[model samples]
Target: MSHDENNAVLFGSGDEAPSNHSHNPHFNELVDARRRQILAGGAALGVLGFLGVGLPGESQAGERHLPPFGRRNRLPFTAVAVGRADGISVPAGYRATPFIPWGTPITGGYPAFLEDASNSAQDQAEQIGMHHDGMHFFPIDAQYGAGLNSRHGLLVLNHEYIDAPLLHPNGPTVVDGKRVSAEQVRKEINAHGVSVVEIRRDVRGEWQVQPSARNRRITAATPMQMSGPARGHALLRTRYSPEGTASRGTQNNCASGFTPWGTYVTCEENWAGYFASRDSDLPRELKRYGLRSSSRFGWDTLSGDEFERFDATRKGADARADYRNEPNHFGWIVEIDPFDPDSVPVKRSALGRFAHEGLVFAKPRAGKPVVCYSGDDAQNEYIYKYVSRGKYRPGRSDGRLLDDGVLYAARFNADGSGDWLALDLQDAAFQQACAAAGVSFADQGEVLINTRLAADIAGATKMDRPEWGAVHPDSNEVYFTLTNNSARTTADAANPRVKNAYGHIIRWREERRDNSGVRFAWDLFLLAGPESDSRGPNGQALGADNMLASPDGLWFDEDGRLWIQTDMSGSQLASGPFGNNQMLVADPHTGDMKRFLVGPLGAEITGITATPDFRTLFINVQHPGEGSTANNLLSTWPDGPGKRPRSATVIITREDRKRLL
Candidate 1:
């Protein structure tokens, strides 16, 4: 999420006042305690010999090798220089083509994009939404070629949030500080969900949207189902779903993941800002997520039940009679089957959500319990993992497996070791810890509902705003990006820097390399910052070729290369050592890193994926011209001069049409 003035309120993770005030042990204290114990011969090994600088057994020699592109583990392309440009920059032999901008028609009467931003709310439902984020490619040829044929597939991506001024012709209509135009508010709501569009490569080797039945848009008004342990709970009961078995829509989706069963899971991030409550005594669920008197967008200021649902206040006699429970219906990982156009999205509540940044499943093995990780992208939040109760079967698995699982919050201990504290109500340790903290759960449903509070009681480590997570394709080691937390005044083993302006990446390996294990060994992969503050895997300061900050989006390609993307704030780009938000790929094994691309001014380079054959790469440039309003624009990207700036996805490939490393 961008930190421009306009986005500061929308992406409230960093700007908003933190709700967590837990008195958990600081990470630096834990590291000091572990070091003392090791030196006193009380411990067997010294995992934090030098504050867990790098992974154990890392090769110091050949760590800085810059061989030309030949081996799969080496970075192939020349590093792109850092600068603040008005467009994208790639290597010499690579071609970057802008594919789908904010408003391109794919379904529903095939409405064309209006240059004047006069498209109606109904038109937005039929067109692409704003601010494209996390995405994946589901090939249509999966049944035949192991889904490697990505030339023609469904390009499913998330629309994080809407730029209100750009969504309307002359900006939004307001009366006495409240939004008056119902259509404008409705259009913004429609642009806050997911887009599943059918895209195929043309004979000219250009990707284009195809008009197919599978090209569907699931927006804020789409009907969905509620599943998992918390489904039909009292906290989820609302007027729209009296039985509490369903929900309205998904919003503020940032990063996403796909299941082995061929389903897509979109994560809800910074969604609490969309809801408002005037009541002083708010429920813990709403209060913990930071719902306040006025919403960032005044959707509830309009006059209808549909718009009034955004006001999550207690007005009616009971929970089912009002929209007080509407906020609870959100914050969960929504599972959608793109292949089945008519399938209703299910909110898998067993995953235990709290401002979910993204969900990444570990490498799956048949007859093993399916495991996945999610970060609660907020200051001083905890990381969570879910392990299925039943073992996964390759061809027979589905979202039902997510309905029954053990959700655990991570507790990164001293000595570079960690434990997965189970949130289960029946677990003896969990029960005793809750009892000690004067916290008790009625059942598993309540435990999952108050996930953040439960994590605090479980003594989970306070992290520096955990965000997107990825699992190594071969080693199954999980890596998470702890984006910058400027509010931190104390250091800990997991978060070493106080007042951490630039973020860092943390990686861990489960016991015996088992994703379902309760213990793990962890280390700091990269301390992201300028050349002076940042440290690479070789325990050295980063060079000009790989300087970065606020590492947000992350992924491990099939070849085990770690692709890192940055989401630095607008102010950071103006005064920091790094010029623009960029993307870099690194060999986790050797610590060699290279800058691959740099985005335009005020744009965040996020949401990256590639064809299975490794020939093409797809990435999203969000909020180009970060602080742009209707009158004062900062950028006109993808489309040249005289055109309004629109966020879009860029498609890149090798010049010789060979595989892209």
Candidate 2:
């Protein structure tokens, strides 16, 4: 089946009152007229209210009644706020039930997690990983057999980072500013990567963790094979993988995607900043990829082969014999066949490089090519897509179908139309550009490994920290979050603002076509800011209710409900009047946005997913009061009082079984 069969369009022209035009002149005029009409109608309503005959809730004589777009309902259920010891607050109607917390046994064979527990790398894999982010649920069919619904399916989640202090029995001690133990380093390494746990609902409708045939954990030490255009490039070669065909582990798996064929696509984000590198010791090419001279976490100063090897800066005599391949292993989309417990994950090089935030696939058409969109997850990086050259075969659920594709980086133009620039090594321009950049590649393989260089040569627009993205169900329009960029980066035509602290959501529709088309029209949907900031020609504010800074996680539900979650630094959280970070729901058509839930103090509201029934929603509350040290705990959320803040996934459902949207 094609994507259109399962996806529904959420917004149409009727939903948008277009006055603020994007680069598209035609759309600008069309939207402007609608905005004027909306304003005029609003004014008429105000006048009628003054006369007292036609009140706010009442309609004029013979006029039809409009639905309540912004008014609050006496919702049958109330939202219960969940917090830790420091008192993390949530919305009033919802209660949070911890589904998976740090160190929970994932595989069922392990001993229960103890707060100060120290497990070997192998044992840790059987246990839940650290910092759970994006997660999703797959329901099992009864046809698969009894206990199937209760023990089948997978819960794939990302392990963003490790909490060093809590992971060890004692705090990670830096003796002379360098860690002294190899065991400490080993624990940290095991903490990063993705976890897949089997879960099921019992007769009572309560979900339970199960140790099943499909329960597994993939960590930073798991072996992964490279596929597609850049498979065996020289840049991927290291002592670990002499042929450049394989790499060890995946880190920073953030917001993710699942294939129509039922596989999981986990993204590698913020992977660059983890490696320790010094200016003098690193190669010029490596530095360009954001591995500047200094290490952000100071992990390299620690002892042990694992901790020291995490630093990409060279210390050995030969590049091929040392840690050179470490950088190459990361920054790619790692695909996992979740149903096949024994299958190895494959990193498709055809997708290109950079800090990937998430990947979303379009519904594949029978005769048309398959299209997938992704973000670079960094300030001033570019957006990209991979279009398969071969047509998608419907109902073909095999894994190998995703192996081949033509990668293209987007160039969104000011005129409202955009082009997808191909990054094919066979192209003459690409060959010439590669030669000029002092990079040698025999085929598309090398180009995929050095995708940033290729996009630079192609002149793709640099966006402000592009993060998570989702394609609208109905319109086939693509939307991506440009999470906040600090004052340091330069702003160009594509990114026209300076010091864009409060990020924005930009979206655009294809011109008379779907994802397979080479060209499309575009527009900026909403500029996120605080209410006190500024308003567009339409009454939409750049602030609080409407203004959300650092829009990270976004997903469109089966019912076409757009859910947005935010992630703000601690400094921004305390001073802003918006209270704390929150999740907002918006109707794309009417531009009706409302705050649904707020996170705890010093915590970021990340990763969100909804069940097909739209009855249960799962959200991750990550690192509450993150900046607090061992001696000082700012927010005791999820675990009030003596407990340290634990990153966890909260499951929410209406007690009455009503539709959440």
Candidate 3:
């Protein structure tokens, strides 16, 4: 059957909600026009003839009316809610099953996950890490072909953070502000890393994790290579790797991306806070990068040299001997070839860093530079893009193709025009700025090591907590989730919202460069909030669709369906103003968004990916029913019936045997 016919049969056309007259007549008109356009497009696609779906009639004479939030269901598919009592929650009609949970064995004879399971640091490497976030499934075909039935392949997932308390038999404790137990610290270290698991579907169409030779885990102690402009820089010199040629491991692997050639790009964010340092003990360079100044979480107070190095203070003596190089090793995008278990992950310095979120690659076209977009993921950071020096060679499987590139920081102007400010340290403007700032750099290595400072000197536009990004399937437009910023940043023209507790999704379309255009047009696609409290077209209050705060994870399926996930705090969930953190699907062309699924209590729904056939969707439910103490558990979710909640990855598939797109 044709794709259009399938969509119509899956998602009926008459699922639109009833309209009600309320506020902002102009917004009402826009809503009506959008509905009309969707109906017309659906008919043009021949979706109306399939399944006997009827289209809404056109009328411009009625009174202004607004639809309730999440009332419209233009998309074809049903949400299926699933969880292990304390696991993630999905929509109805869907079943959620676990792929791999914490402490699950990978290889090397590690045993299955058991609460309070005792294991050494090396054994922990063989087990699954904590807090599974963004993930991608690369199907293995008979000959690596692109067919839906090709279900055997590798699943690459990022373990964002470790549950330090439960990871060890005893919690990570400190005596007199010093970590007393080395074993506890070691367990915490081993519990933070990435897991690559091999999965396959059986003859009955059930997905299961199968142990394979390719299955491996890259941990904190693993030796990694440094590449690009920042290789062998003075700042990277550490006693562990004195030559500055290598670093220990990748931490804070949050959201992630996949290369067209089949590699995993896991991002390291919030690594600075892991270290501890005092103002008087830090170097001038360390203080400049927001480290040593003040740490949000004081991990340095723990005892031993291992925990002390976590604090990037200049304690030992010389720069090489001291822990000065600690901060330099982090905050870069780490790339790993999932297929090769022994491959050393490369921290690509070409992608300028700052709280690096995941990196998304655009479809490579001939005569155009390979382009990738990334977000800084801080309260007032910036969105960045890297354009490769050479055109992307499709179907190439080598890992070296991503090593060389030109990084650019985005500057969104008020006139709907945006410019990609070049981040090359060799540029005349950059050199002059560096000299003026008294920041002397020997080469691009220094620039990348201190990328946040370089972007600052270049006067890049600071954004509001930029998160995961996705590329439009048909139009090539790029969309990113700008999660809320609570910092009291003044209202500027580009970001003209005050105390933006509720965030928005900012998107732009390139003018010419495929996805590498230096010039582009941009706009605020949607402002998330409850329908009764949002400002409409004329700046008046009106009901909006799919209102929620803090947009975090974003993904676009092969069918151009945009999935938006939320990461709301406990306070927001407790209040009746909104439902549990959920995922919403929208049609970008018509601005039609609907809430697809609501997660379990105290859980933030994140890290979503779809199967090749669009029949299965995978999402991560992190920290379910969090903030529940030993006495007052707000929720008894996946661990229902007297059990604690465990963060997990849920595979969602419809039970009716219909396609989910």
Candidate 4:
């Protein structure tokens, strides 16, 4: 899912639709030390405790107290078994209702959906786009109190990308080396972006979308500003913005993040291949990000202002006259003020861009700098953290706060310890290392533009496709999913499995239990595989009960329950007992995991968020019936027979209306 669009994972990267990972050396020693620690009854050796954390009733920074995370968020539901159902499977007493599907109108300007799939590009702009992904709900101030109506909130979610085969009337029609239909191209263009619509629960507790002026769509053509060190760099100048201050569109938005001040962060993952660069002397960063000779969608093959923009090659005299720098504007964390749909999305450049899996904040202190943790969603990629230079006041604006921050790449040492190396080009060690690698770092912007290269220069640990990250709501401890890497030829102590196919979870504690720290301790939380391979001392797998693979979408509910979602490929779904990708509940405190819901065929269960009351939960089903064509459909879920399989969001709740465990 991280490398290519057609092969695997979910609709794109990051497991869930709107969703959103590494290790390092000290190699054999780290492994030997961990093994010794485990044998000495230190299997619980991960950096877990928070020495600086203050308990409830004590003077504290915020309303919540993270009382040693994992042990607190336990669930009481029974774990479901694997199944090969053609439709999604949920536990008894829990009902899953189809909430919103692709093409649903969110604004007054949008037209009703057409089952024949003949919606216009203009129509999609006003309607809900395809492939719903990571999302968050921001309750308005008036309805913010508990026991109040929890439905009147802005529902913000990512439309990852379209399912091409089903999107077009008869698939994409190609003619004369180009798409024969201009309207189809327009439809596809409008289909990719973020959707913010207002939803409300009625007196009967039924959630429904209502038309409002606030309903808006931020698409691939919308204008966006660049915010950090890379904002006005020479490499970012393009025909659209000669000063390199801004760019258009926010594509490949996978996972999402919500700020304490009420802004939504939409991350761009796997955005490189969407552009085409034909220059012979393209920058190393451009080629490394996978800007190719032609885009997979081939939108560049068509002619017109809208279509030609997809071609990022240098066709004019210089960067100012061409679109060569267009791709550079992407691969960032785009922050949108969901409450203000008319507001412009800002590309927070301080967060060094890679295949941005998602963005989640480290727990904040009353007057301390805000911290962010993210993973580069690719095989053997590195994880990153951004510590803002400015302190975030509880009521101060959260937007633009990410503009000035120190981006750090992680380096794991052998003895369960790690360091966050600064990706600063001015650092003497960085300068020497860059010189040795035959790379030149002229300024801080260059380091951010060439983040992957900078990380290499910094000796960061490579991970097995790090995906979504979930920070404990109370503790701020981080948990990242190292989604499997089948390309590994040799196994390392940190990445235990050779030809690692099943993936695992890695958790780390910040130094002194503070979010803003340069050092930390780490450990492997779970080695995901078949049930047999995950067995324990008594020959039984899991002290609780769960067998899964490629852990992708993850989130920590208010009550501290860690939700684990699977992202088995369409081909990999049948390879083991881990049937079609599903959602599982995990107890970080006890390391107990249980299966919750299993999705339909050819789909990945992703994008989950809950209402404040926890009585309503939302999860997205991406690319269901993926390989099926119009004539030979694979599934009929959420809809009756004879309809195209759609990427949709499912609302799950207890039959008794109890809070989600």
In TM-score terms, which candidate is top?
1
lDDT of 4 by residue, 1-661 (tens): 2222332321233232111121234232345545544323324322232222232222332122445544443567777778777787787788888877888988756698887788888888888888888998777552234424467787889988777668877667655444557788888878988998888888987888877888898888889889889989998998888999988888888888887677889999878777777877778778667665756666777787677777888788888887788788888999998877678889988898788989988877768888889998877678999888888897664766788878888887666677788888656777787787787877888789888878877788777788999998776778898888786766555555567788877777776444777777666667677755552212235432578888999999886668988888855796666788888886665555688998988887889888888889999998787776677688766686899888888989889998867
Off by over 4 Å in 2: 1-93, 117-123, 141-152, 277-281, 293-308, 313-318, 397-399, 428-440, 488-498, 534-539, 542-547
Where is model 1 more than 4 Å wrong at Cα?
1-16, 33-73, 143-145, 491-496
Candidate 2: tens digits of C-alpha lDDT, residues 530-609: 66543321335543444566788888876445678888775567675555777776655445566667777777788887
Report the Cα lDDT for candidate 4: 0.75
Worst 10 residues of 1 by lDDT: 41-50
TM-score (C-alpha, index-matched) for candidate 4: 0.90
C-alpha lDDT of all candidate models, in order: 0.83, 0.65, 0.66, 0.75
Residue 590, candidate 2: C-alpha displacement in angstroms: 1.4
**Every model's TM-score:** 0.93, 0.82, 0.83, 0.90
Residue ranges of candidate 3 with Cα displaced over 4 Å? 1-74, 77-89, 117-123, 142-149, 279-285, 293-308, 435-438, 489-497, 535-545, 628-634
Quote the lDDT for 497 in model 4: 57
What is the overall TM-score of model 2 with all chains considered together?
0.82
Each candidate structure's count of clashing pairs: 5, 33, 20, 14
Ordering by TM-score: 1, 4, 3, 2
Per-residue C-alpha lDDT of model 3 across residues 440-459, encoded as one tens digit per residue = 76777777776666676666
**What is residue 418's positional error in candidate 2, in angstroms?**
1.7
